[model samples]
Target chain A: MIAALMTKKEWITNNVRRKNLGAHVLGVTAFAGGHIAVHWLMPSGQVVQDNWDMHGLEFPSLTVELPEMAWDEREIHDVFGYRPQGHPDLRALVRNPRWPDEFYPMAGLNAPQKPPWREVAPNNPEQTVEGEGVTIMKVGPTHAGIIESGHFVFSIIGENILHLDLHLFQNHRGVEGQLQGRLIGSVAPLISRICGADTVSHQTNLAMAVEEMAGYQVPDEIKWQRILLLESERILSHLNDLAQIPAGVGFSVANQKALTMKERWQRGLTVIFGHRLLFDTVHPGKSLAMDTAALGALITQLQREWRPWRSLVQGHHGFQDRMKGVGMVRQSDALRFGGQGVVARASGLTFDARQLMPLYHGWHVDYASETSGDVSGRFKVRLDEVEASWRLMQGVLQRYQIHSALPFWEPPTDLIGQAATFSESPHGLNAHIVAVDRGKVIRYHVRSGTFRNWPLLSKAVAGNAVGDFPLINKSFELCYSCLDR
Target chain B: MGKSIQVLQLRHVDAGSCNGCEQELTALGNRFYDMQHSGIDVVASPRHADGLVVTGPVTDTMKRPLMQDWDAVPEPKWLIALGDCAAGCGVFQGAYACYSGVASVRPPDLVIMGCPPLPQDILRQITVWRKTLD
Candidate 1:
């Protein structure tokens, strides 16, 4: 049986040929009950989702045709024990290597086998390009910097990188597995903490899904307040990346200046939202006990500080030399890797969930662009987004009125259906799909922009100077922890 | 306030944090908190550190690396569990991937309790500890 969302056709569920469906896959997902849904972005600028019911726990491999679907399908295999039959290169993704191959965390502990650890396997170097003068370098699950845990296997000839194999999920904290069977509303805090860099996006996306499930309409005051938090958070996250890109180039002056600005912004956020990372600011239905006047003051203070600092860093020739034309990601590679947010826009793909998803509909989102798809392009994208976010924040703040509502998600506690939500975080498109059964979360899956954009880091790194990894990575500024979640 | 200060160099091990703690820990080096003002620093390697700053709930995958990094610190080194998750696992108590708290790996000399403790709080505590060496 085949179902289609293209050509304005209702999902026709019947025995139909496989070749009838269109290409250009945006993402592939498995909802509750192992139903594989393929979202296709058509030529008319409309996204159409086609879903397929798996016969038992097996689905035909779509990765054979669409490489972007690889991660999604691999994740489905790891968590749900659903095998993607005939797929090439199915390996451990969400699961760490130490876990027994049979231990699928999403299978619910009540099923036959209980969750247990197995003895660790010996460390084997991951695959690399092999030939004369080719050397392999491995850097972190630990690094020289105050950064998250992830490893990179780079194959290089002299200073130029031949290829990069990124080994992630090294710190897989089992966030999705942990959320099972918890009350729908109770999981927002945990969701918010999925990754500090993406706190607001995670919470807001979850809130949207749960709100959809409960048929609840957020009041106008709270809606604007939520937008305000999202934009402020966007500024903070992007600022961290801006500071990082400079440090990659050993430009301490710009790095420290950006860091100082970030700290100032975070302190102001704490004054208004009660959390540094904007956590707890976007819980379902609930409004904050906020200082609305302080919100205005914070925005004004940051704007006063931003102008001179921006020009000083952006104009630096040393920083420009390191970033421009380094680590270029082809637009073709961007599309193949399921590029979503910053990377896609920088690489000349006009695919932003902000513009494409219903979650961000009606909001005027102005994004930055760079056709070269180089390190400088990604850096400029973040720099531009910082201002775009500030503008969006001011628009919301101008319309914001103090809302005195109580703690918020699904209050009626009778949520029994499935809903998916998306948000354009500072990182790009952050997504969450949740299914509640009698008020408890039965199935939850998160696909962050980082999860989608990580492969692009390797794609861009090839042929660039090996030392360029840090600058290239910082330019994209993808979150390791969010994807680890 | 009259006593001379000795630097307390530290290395950070992100056992399995959601990155909220790392965000603040990194900010400690920025101009605002400036842990360096107190002669406290986050060194690149454990071999140069006087202590370990551990965050997250000790995920199963990170347990060995965390122990290896902690062992790399010179003797007389202390471990400070830097967040609610590291101190006692906070929201991740029964998570399958987590060992619950840093103590489950090795007991910490100090536990600073914020989901991610404020950068000021983190610096103040480290500065206070640096005085203990005097």
Candidate 2:
């Protein structure tokens, strides 16, 4: 980890636009005392962190050089009132019309002033494509079924789609704003709520980041337990995605079969770990450790449950016909958009956080990549990952022999610096940046896999049939709550 | 209005939920819970629904829509708050984005509590509601 203090202009010119750069921007965060930090990850797991001291809310934007920085910059603007001078699109990202114009929530700029009660626009209007018979169909903010609300406006002619304008943040809850001044230890439960499906990953990422801040390390047994929790989360989330795919194509039987397996898997997790979703199960330097016997039984149960569904789903031709060659994300586009996890892997980009980070070094998990970059590709990647997670759990259980749970390591109260960490979430790479001052959190930023992958969704859905939107969307499984948070 | 209804059509409104409640709600329809067997059907629109199965703490952005949907529900419709968030904002209470649960918008006939109540819990609540009506 390398942290450098540079001028905003120098930082942008030197690092943001530099050719032959090996790092990807994790996120841009803002601190109370005029500090702007950009967390980046080099190809070799090394974090190249840069902090610029700004007098006020003005800073040089990196959007021109790296388009992916646009969302982060906009969020920074919304949260901290940081004016990104050169940002191409400086529209309100998360701050809705309900929020007062000058009040910034994250920085706590205007605490005494309550935002006035007024009627506000429900969502931002989409940029429509103008042409003859180019009708637009808008879906969600409040969707059918139990899915997260995200408004997608599809400009279509007949059944073919021309462009999909996505408007997320309808569920934005100002999660970062709420985390301020809390003890580092108390933030896990709140972090878990950032996204429900990937609760373990969110907690692990936040936990790992806070632990890094305090310079603490867990015992091997606890480390394995954390990995076990993470892998279990991955398996269940991927299974959820798998079920969605079959359901998307009207294959209800296959869908139910997979969902039943997932339920059984989750039930086993609940029996062993005490929480079906495993919320608050992981904390800094420790996790809710499972007994070796229960874990073994869970693994055996999973093996028995997964085999039949895996065989049937993989062999089914109708499911394949619907999933294959649909929602294709090109290699160049994936790279350009900074795609991570299944979205990138399916596009043949071998960019998994586990492969890069030291935390997951000992875990013998296989990286699943498919060059097709289609719905089938993403589906196949998720299926392979579920199997890989199952294998990893089996491996961890075999190697670690312990009768009781590992003892928790206490975090030092004296924390003064920033710590950034990333984890392979079920959807993609989940990155968290934490800034602490004297034991209390000053700045906390969580960039979920959905945040990174949502951009790719708009790109991927283009040129596909209007009816294929659900299938394409289900394949991505991007959570609006995570993105909104 | 007084007639005993056979099929209960539920329209789910996500009033700033954490997706946890939504997950459990989705699971209720799966083979394990099989909510359809009990005559609870999740319709696409509130116009065609008998009740509103709501989730999340009513956020500023979603409050208007939630109220609009509530008004859209026909006479003799039930409003069931699905999780702690909807029941009373759960942990997300007092946050800037939240309006302190769906009860703030309109008091629910039934409130299912849990950070996110399980599918079985939801099924049990629906069954209880069914029994009371019968």
DockQ of all models, two decimals each: 0.57, 0.67
- For each candidate in turn, the TM-score is 0.91, 0.95
Give the fraction of native contacts in model 1. Answer: 0.63
Error of 2 at B122 (Å): 1.2
Off by over 4 Å in 1: A1-27, A31-34, A39-49, A109-114, A121-125, A356-363, A402-410, B1-5
Quality of model 2 by C-alpha lDDT:
0.81
Give the per-residue lDDT digits (tens) of candidate 2, residues A84-126: 8889987877877778777777766322223563577766657
lDDT of model 2, residue B115: 79
lDDT score at residue A422, model 1, on the 0-100 scale? 73
Off by over 4 Å in 2: A1-9, A17-19, A109-114, A403-408
Calculate each model's fnat, 2 decimals: 0.63, 0.64
